[model samples]
Target chain A: MKDDYKDKLDSLPVDIKLRAADRLKIHLMRQKYGYFSRLCLLMALIGPGILVMIADNDAGGVMTYAQTGSIFGIGFFIPFMIVMLPVAYIVQEMTVRLGAVTHRGHAEMIWKRYGKFWGAFSLIDLIIANVLTLITEFIGITIGMRVFGVPPLISSISAVLIIASIQLFLRYFAWEWISLSIAAFNLVFVPLVFFVPHLHWGAVARSFGTWHIKGGVSSLFIYVVLANLGTTIAPWMLFFQQSSVVDKGLTVKDIRDGQFDTFIGSVFMVIVAIAIILITAGTVYGLTQTPNLDIQTILSAISSKMGPLAMRLFALGLVEAGLIAAIAISASTSWAMGEAFGWPKSINMPPIEGWKFYLPGVISLLIAGGIVLIPNAPLGFLNLTVQVVATIFMPAAMMFLLLLLNDKEIMGEHINKHWQNISAFTIVGFLIIMNFMYGLTVVFPHILG
Target chain B: MIKYIDIIGFNGKRCDMKNNKKTSKDINLDEDWEDFIKEEGLIDYNKIPVQKAEIKGWVQIAFWFLRIYILVMIIMVIIGFSRIK
Candidate 1:
């Protein structure tokens, strides 16, 4: 019987054989171990969700959280971040199912199911957003390294080499593990919060009850809230997670473990985010000092108030955030391109066999890193471009996600329930209104008045 | 046998077997591609309802909003770029 099975397997194509081997390994593991096999199964299926959520707390995201604490003193955003936990989970969990059930990346599903125009639209938006966002990550990485006395050239080259090596050399499993190992450092901010002198636990607790908007519903408050929402969920995330899930070879049976992974990741993201907020709110904002709280200003304030150890740890967290996000975004870009153009895409493929697949991501990363190395590269404008592109494409991305999630034929028994749709629609509506508000504020500066 | 193998692995693009004639080793390939597709629910992709009128209204509204949003953002980016320069 074993020989017969071997014979049948030998007859299959290479792609199908690779998939079958992976499936058979999981099947054998489950067959050998009964109830405890679940742990093993989860270990295999944990990458996409956790990686996605952690990467969501990218360099820009960390800065945004710190700014939230510094500008608003963490009164509103602490509880607000807590609320986003479920919102993030609900939105991301749908991708897990879509990926597992369809066995196609989000971009592929969009292109195949919906026609050329919308598909091309989403692909362009995703690639452009991803490239611009990668620039931000590289910027963050360089800036963080600078805080530690590393020059920008050394920082950019080192980051580029590190990220390129990870993508080019490692397979999916090793890639996920290495990336997670780095992502664990993002928790350094959680501990750094303790270094803030005389932080009152009661004040943090009271903010939830006092959930009132601190300075009334002014335009700044609105802008901060929209920034938070935008940071929490974005276009790249949907493509990244879904493609990662497909690349990981998750099936419908793995959805439960996938959801568990996303939940744990969301919890980690919220915790780290809240910790940054607490640190800033306790130290910088508590000092009643709010003057141009960009990331550089916030880091300096953290150093002055919390001392060097705390500052170094925050810098380390920023570096980790940037590194992990760059890694994930680069991979997602490769996967999206492969999916869109029908190229053979799996990290499982060696660089030699899959250079076409890896070329786009590597080229984009190189360009981003090169741009960061240039002196006075109009980084402010580049940053704005990233933000503007993300804001523009968000509604369309959210709409595609919702439509795919609700398709009866595709999702079948797993189609979203009514309440789930309601919750998703509410989130979408909130994002749309926020996008318009943000756009108007940009186009007409006095609209806030 | 060669025809059977070609049929099994046949993607939309034409199978170019001009240089390499049929060999018996090619017959070694088995497992119908149709079965693989069925098992993976590949056909269900086409069955997805992208243009149902019931859903078209909301989708249309979203596209319109997205179009206007993209235009405004492009202008905003240009203005931002100029200001920085």
Candidate 2:
């Protein structure tokens, strides 16, 4: 029977085979160790959630958190970030159910259910946001490398090669494992929090009580808030996690384990975000005279304030952030495209079988890397544009997610509860309002006035 | 173009039928339509039945609102980018 099953699996397509292998592992684990299968199940189901959340704390995300601390201090944003934990988990948890129940990625579901118009809308938004976001990752990589005396050309080339190889060589489970290993380094920011001079537990504690904005309700404050929101829940995250859950072969039976995975990821994500905020808030906040410092300048501030070791550690964090995000985002682009066009896509496939699947992601990375290496690219503007585009498209993504989650046909018994829909729609409503405010400020600089 | 409903003698069927009483080998066909007809019990093809989607009235309203919302966002993004010299 086992041999026959293996033969059947061997005849299946590469994508299906990968999912079957994952399902088989979970099945075997449950069959073998009935009592302690919970641990085994979590171990197998841990990748997609942790990868998505930590990758959410990407280079751009880390920079935003750092800038948050440097600009506003940790008073308001730390508590705000802690609040984002449930927000992120609740939002991502729906994707788990959607993927498991439907056995389809977000793009496929959108296209198949909502017709071509919304499908094309999501695809275009995702592709543009993904490419622009990849440029930021490369920017993070090159900038972080420059701190270590590596030139941009060498850094970009090495990064592109490493990212491509991560996608091309490893299968789904191995790819997730390797990506998680890299993502673990994002924790370097956590310990660096302890290096803060005269770091006060009281201030961090008092901020939750106060929940006060330092500069009051200003345009820069709104910009930073929108940027944090952009980094927290973007369209790519929705696509990426749903596709990953599908790829990992999670079913309705595995939804509990999936939620557990996302919960763990949310905890890790918020902790790391808070740590980056602390690191910057400790070393750079009031000590520096400049109110508006770029990420590089912020790194230099950390170096001068906390010494060389801390500086290098922070830079290492940046590299890891960029590298892991590149891996996940590249895979996300591949998965989204494949699902949209109904092409074969899986990290499990060999180069020959899945070259069509891998081409778009690798080419995107290459283009982003090339853009980063250009002599006089306006990286700051590019970064802002990425954040802006992501912010703008966020409502559409959230709306689709809400619609899909509330759909009785697709979700059935696993549909969103009353509280889930309320919370999800509330978040969507907040995003629409924030996008409107951000747009007004962009169009009319004196709108706030 | 023999309808599965004609063969099974059950017209006006929606996606409610979920019984997998027959396997693919029983039909001796590997075509996608055969799999769909058997797997989904989609015997009725005369009326344009809603396959797996259930977009009712309020849902339709929400969907169109989102469409307009997304369009406005795209415009805002264009304006935002154009200002980014």
Candidate 3:
């Protein structure tokens, strides 16, 4: 049987062969009956959900959380982030089922099912938002590295090379494991919370009751809320996770494990988000009420309040956030392009064999990395544009996801339950309302005020 | 027997294999192939064309909603960016 299996594998194409090799291990693991075997099988099945959730706390997300903490303190956002766990989980879990049931990425599903116009619209929006978001990742990378005496040019170039090489060289399994390993470093902020000089546990616990809005509700408050929402669930996450699951070869049998993976990831994402909020709220809140609260300001506040080591650890976490997100985002770009264009798409493909699939991602990285190194680029404007694009595109993405999930022909038995539709619609409704309010705030700068 | 599979290669070019051959080892009539395909979730998705969905009932309403939503958002963005300076 072993010889026969090897013979069968040898007869397959290279990309499929690599994926089959990994899936073959999973197949064998499934045949065994024990607690240990079940644990092993779960370990094998859990990657896409966790990776997507952690990558959700991208470089831009880190800055947003830090800014939220500094501006609003821990009162509102702590409990708010706790609520986001379910929001993040509910939104991401659908992707797992979509991928597992159809063996197709989100882009491919949209392209084929919805016809060309909506397909082009989605692909263009995704690619633009992804490139802009990648710029923020590069910004985080360069800024964080500058703390350790590295220049922007070297850091940006090196980051591009590293991310591109990882995508080009590694198979899907190795790529996922390496990316998750980097994601683990995002926990650096969690422990640094303990070192905060005057972090009051009572205040943290009491936040659930108050959900306090500092200085009443204003435009700044709405902007911060929307920013946090944007970070928690972005359009990239939908495309990325579905593509990741498809690439990792998840099936209906693994859907439960995939959901569990997403749940665990959601917990981690919220914990890290709250940790950053707590760290900044403890240190920077009430110290500076500056409207333009950049990360350098936050880092300095951490240095003065919590010593240089904690500050440095925070910087390290920032770098990891940027790096992990770049890997995930760029790969999503590549995956989406391949899916839309009917190209062979898999991280398992060898570099030479998969150059077409790898080009879009690498080009995006170069554009972002190069832009960050240019002196006096409008980075703040770019960041705001990222928010605006995500705001506009998110609901559309969700609508498509909901449409696909509810489709009887594609999903069959794995169709979304009644509760799932209600929950998703409620999320969409909330997002549209918030986006409308956000737009109003933009049009009328003092509307909320 | 010679078999050929046309694959889309680099740059959207179609490359055809000339001397592809299948032997007994390649033909897995056993349960292993089915198990492998099932576990791997390997579907030739490119080969199976998904039909254009009939956008009616609630789906049409959703599409209309999306169109209005996007148009409104784009106008707001234009206004917002116009006032950026």
Question: DockQ, in order, for the candidates?
Answer: 0.07, 0.08, 0.20
List model 1's recovered fraction of native interface contacts, to 2 decimals.
0.09
Q: How do the candidates rank by TM-score, highest first?
A: 3, 2, 1
Ranking by lDDT: 3, 2, 1
lDDT of 2 at A438: 76
Q: Which numbered prediction scores highest in DockQ against the true structure? A: 3
| Model 1 misplacement above 4 A | A1-16, A32-34, A286-292, B1-85
**Number of the top TM-score candidate:** 3
| Backbone clash count for every predicted candidate, in the order shown | 0, 0, 0
Candidate 3 C-alpha lDDT tens digits along A1-449: 45666677778766666677677666655555556556767888898888999999998999999999998897988999999999999999999999999999999999999988999999999999999999999999999999999999999999999999888888787789999999999888899989988889999999999999998888888888899999999999999999999888888989999999999999999999999999999899988776579899999999999998898999999999999999999999999999999999999887777899999999999999999988999999998889888999999999999999999999999999999999999999999999999899989998877
lDDT of 1 by residue, B6-82 (tens): 22322211212222233223332244434433443323232343442233777668667767767776787666456
Clash pairs of candidate 1?
Answer: none
**Candidate 1 lDDT tens digits, A289-388:** 3423678777888888889888888988888999999999999999999888888777766687679889989998999999988887887777777877
DockQ of the two-chain complex in candidate 2: 0.08
lDDT of 1: 0.78
Docking quality band of candidate 1, CAPRI definitions = incorrect
Chain B TM-scores across candidates: 0.40, 0.39, 0.57
